[model samples]
Target: MLEDKKDGWKAAIALAPAMIFLVVFMFFPLVNTTIMSFMEGFQFRANAGIFAISHRYQGIGFQEYINVLRDPIFLTALKNTMVMVVISVPISVILGLLVSVCLNNIKRLQNIFQTIFFLPYVTNTIALGMVFKVMFSTNNGLINLIVETFGGDKIAWLTDATTKGYWSALFVITCYTVWSGLAFKILVFLSGLQSIDKQYYEAARIDGASRARVFWKITVPLLSPMIAYITITSFIGAFKAYESVIAVFGRGSYIFGPAGDTNMWITVVGYVYKLLPSLMTPGNLSKASAGSVILLLIILAFTGIQLYVSKKRVHY
Candidate 1:
C-alpha cells in the first residue's frame, strides 16, 4: 500500500506543473471573465488606495444583451465576418489540398518548393500586413501601378464598395488571408496525404483505374478527416482576420470607403475594441460582456456543427 501511495504521489508531482498552468492560465481567466459578464460595471473606484476600500455595486440586467441584439452595427459586423469566412476558408482549404497533392508527387527539389510555400506561415503578421496594405492600396500601390500599365484606371482594392450599401472589405482581406493561409493548409494536407497507403493507388491502377478515379475513390475518402480538421481550424482563424483589414484600412472609421459610412467591416471582436472605452459606463460594459458571450456561443455552435457533420462523414 505504501509503495502504491508513493507511486501515485510521484505521478501527481510530475503533473503538477501542467495542472498549475491550466488553472492559472486557462481556467482562472475564463472563470473570472464569465463572472465579469454577470457583473454590473467594469471598473470600480474604492474609498482608499490600500485596506480602507469598499466594493460598491451598479448592477445591470438583460438590457445589456438586448442592446447588443438591437445594434445595427453589430449585425453588420456579423454579416461581414460571415462573408469573409464564406469566401476565404473553403478556397484556402481546396487550394492547399491541391498544392499539397502536387508537391507530394514531385520527386526533385521538393524541399525547396515546400520551404518557399511555407515561408508565409512563419512571417510576422504586423510586417506582412503592412506590406499587403501597400500592395493593395488604392493610390500608387504596386497592384494599382500594374493596372495602370495595362491601361486600366486605378482601383481602390481596399476601399471600394462591392455593392450599394455593402462593404467590400472582404476583397482586400481575402487576398492576404488566402496568401498566408495556404501554408498551414498545405502542411496539414501533406501530412494527411503522407499517411495514405501507396498500395491503394497501386491496386487501383492495376484494376485499370484512371488517376482521377483513384483520387476520388481512394484519396478523398481517406483525406476527409484531415479536411474536416482543417475546416474547423480555418473557421476559428476567421475571427483573427482583423489584423490585415485594420492594417490596410484604419480602424473606427467606415469600412468600404470615405463615402461608405456604413460600418460594414467591424467584426464582433473589433466591436469589443470599438466599445472598450464606453465600458466604463455600467450599462455599456454589460452590453460588451453580452457581446463577448454571444461571440463565445457562436464559436461553440460552429465547432459543434462541424464536429457533428465531420463525424458523420468519417469512415473509420
Candidate 2:
C-alpha cells in the first residue's frame, strides 16, 4: 500500500506541469470565453492609475448567440466551411490511402519517396498556400501557360470570382487543402499498412485472390482503425481551416460576383478572427465568444458522430 501510494504521488507530480499548463492555457480560456459569451453590455474604462484599464459587463443572456446565428456573413462562412469539409476530407483521405498503398508496395527508393510525399506536411502552410496562389495566378501561371499552350484561354482562377462566385475560390482552396493535408494521412496509413501482418496477404495469394480482392478483404479491414482516426482528425482540421484562405486571399477579402460581393470563403475560424478586433470596443466580444463556442460545439458534435460511427464500422 505504501509503495503504491508513493508511485501514485510520483505520477501526480510528473503530471502536474501538463495539468497546470492545460488549466492556464486551455481550460481557463474556454471557461472565460463561455462566460463572456453570455454577457451583453461591456465597457472599458481607465482606472485612476495611469496605464490601467478595466472592463464592465452587463446583461447576461443569449442575445449575442442569437446575433451571431443571424449574421449573414457568419451564415455564409458556415456554409463555405461545411462545403470545404465535405469536399476536402474524403478526397484527401482517399488520395492519402492510395499514395500510401503505392509507396508501401515499392521496395526500392521507398524512403526517398516517403520523404518527398511528406515534405508538404512539414512545410509551412502559409508558404505552401502562397506557392499554390502563384501557380494558379491569372497571368503567366504554370497552369494557365499549359492551358494556353493547348490553345485554351487563360483562367482568372482566383480573381475571376466575379463571375464564378464561391466556386473559383473554393476550387483553389480545396485543392490546396487536400494537397497539404495528404502528407500526414499518407504517413499514418503507410505506418498502419506496414504494421499489418503479411501472412494475411500470403493466405489471400494462396487462395488465388485478385489484388483488388486482397486489398478490399485484407488491407482495408485491417486499416479501418487508422482510417477512422485520419477521418476524424481531417474533418476537424478542415472545419478549422483559416490560414490557407488568408494566404490565398488578402485579409478580410470576400468572394465577388457580377452583382457585387457575393460571399466570403471565410471558414469558422476566419469568422472568429474577423470578429476579434471588434471585441476591443466591448461590443462584439460576446458575439466573438459566442462564435467560438459555436465552433467548439460543432467540432464536438462532429467528433462525437464520427466516434459513434467508427464504433460500428471500424474493424479494430
Candidate 3:
C-alpha cells in the first residue's frame, strides 16, 4: 500500500505541470467565454481603497446569439464555413488516399515522391496562397492566358467581388484549400498503409482478388480508423478557416468576399476577428463570443456525429 501510494504521488507530480497549464489556458478561457457570450452590457469597476473589483451585465439570455444570428454577415459566415467544410474535407481526403495508394504501390523513388508531395504541407501558407492568387488573377494570369488560348472569355478571378467574381474566387479558394490540405492527409494515410500487414495482401492475392477488390475490401477496411481521424480533423480545420481566407484573398478591401453585395466569403472566425476592432460597440464583444460559442457547439456536434458513425463504419 505504501509503495502504490508513493507511485501514485509521483505520477501525479509528473502530471502537475500539464494539469496546471490546461486549467489556466483551456478550461478557464472556455468557461470565461461561455459566460461572456451572454453579457448584455458588461463593465468592470475597480476600487483600490478597499482592494475590491466589481463587474456587472444588464442581463443574460440568448439575445447575444440572436443578435449574431440576425446579422447578415454572421449568417454569411455560417454559409461559407459550411460550404468549406463540406467541399474541402472530402476532396482532400479522397485525393490524399488515392495518392497514398499510388505511392504505396510503387517501390522506386517512393520516399522522394512522398517528400515532394509533403513539401506543400511545410511550405508557407501565405506564400502559397499568393502564388495561387497570382495564377488566377484577372489580368495577365495564367488561367486567363489559357482561356484566351482556347478562345474563351477571360474570367475575372480575384478582382471583382460581384456574383460572377465570387464564384471564381470561391473556386480558387477551394482549390487552394484542397491542395494545401492534401499533404498532411497523404502523410497520415501513407503511414496507415505501411502499418497494414503484408499477410493480408498476400492472402488476398492467393484468393485471386483483383487490385480493386483488395483495395475496397482489405485496404479500406483496415484504413477506416485513419480515414475517420482525418475526416474529423479536416472538418475542424476547415471550420476555423481564417488563415486560408487571409492568405488567398489578401486582407485588403476585398477580404472574404465580405458577406455583403460583393458576395465574398468569410468564415465565422474571420467575422469574430472583424468584431474585435469595434468591441466598443454595445454588446459587440458578447456577439463575437456568441459566434465563438456557436462555432464550438457546431464542432462538437460534427465530432459527435462522426464518432457515432465511425463506431459502425470504422474497422479496427
CA lDDT, every model vs. true structure: 0.74, 0.82, 0.83
For candidate 3, the TM-score is 0.90
Model 2 residue 199 lDDT score: 91
Clashes of 2: 0
Candidate 1, 1-316: lDDT as tens digits: 9999999999999999999999888877566555555656545455633211122336645666677889988887778778888888998888888899999999899999999999989998766777887886778889889989999987766665556324445666787888888998999899899999899888898999998887787888899999999999999888545665665564432242334553556777777556655434334544566777878788889999999998999768
Candidate with maximal TM-score: 2
> On residues 1-316, what C-alpha lDDT tens digit does candidate 2 reach at each position?
9999999999999999999999888987898788778877544455632111235667878999999999988998898889999999999999999999999999999999999999998898778877887888879778889989999988877776464746877888888889888998998999999999999899999999999999898899999999999999999999898877776654333322212453457677777776664524334667888999999999999999999999999985
Sort every candidate by lDDT, greatest first: 3, 2, 1
RMSD of 2: 3.4
Error of 3 at 261 (Å): 5.0
Q: How many clashes does the backbone of model 3 have?
A: 2
Q: Please report, as a residue range, the 10-residue window in candidate 2 with the lowest summed lDDT.
A: 251-260
Any runs in candidate 2 off by more than 4 Å, and if so which?
43-55, 163-165, 250-263, 278-283
lDDT of 3 by residue, 130-210 (tens): 898788877888989999999999887777667787777778888999988999999899999999999999999999999
Q: How does candidate 2 fare on TM-score?
A: 0.91
Off by over 4 Å in 1: 1-11, 46-57, 161-168, 250-262, 278-284
- Among these predicted structures, which one has the highest lDDT? 3
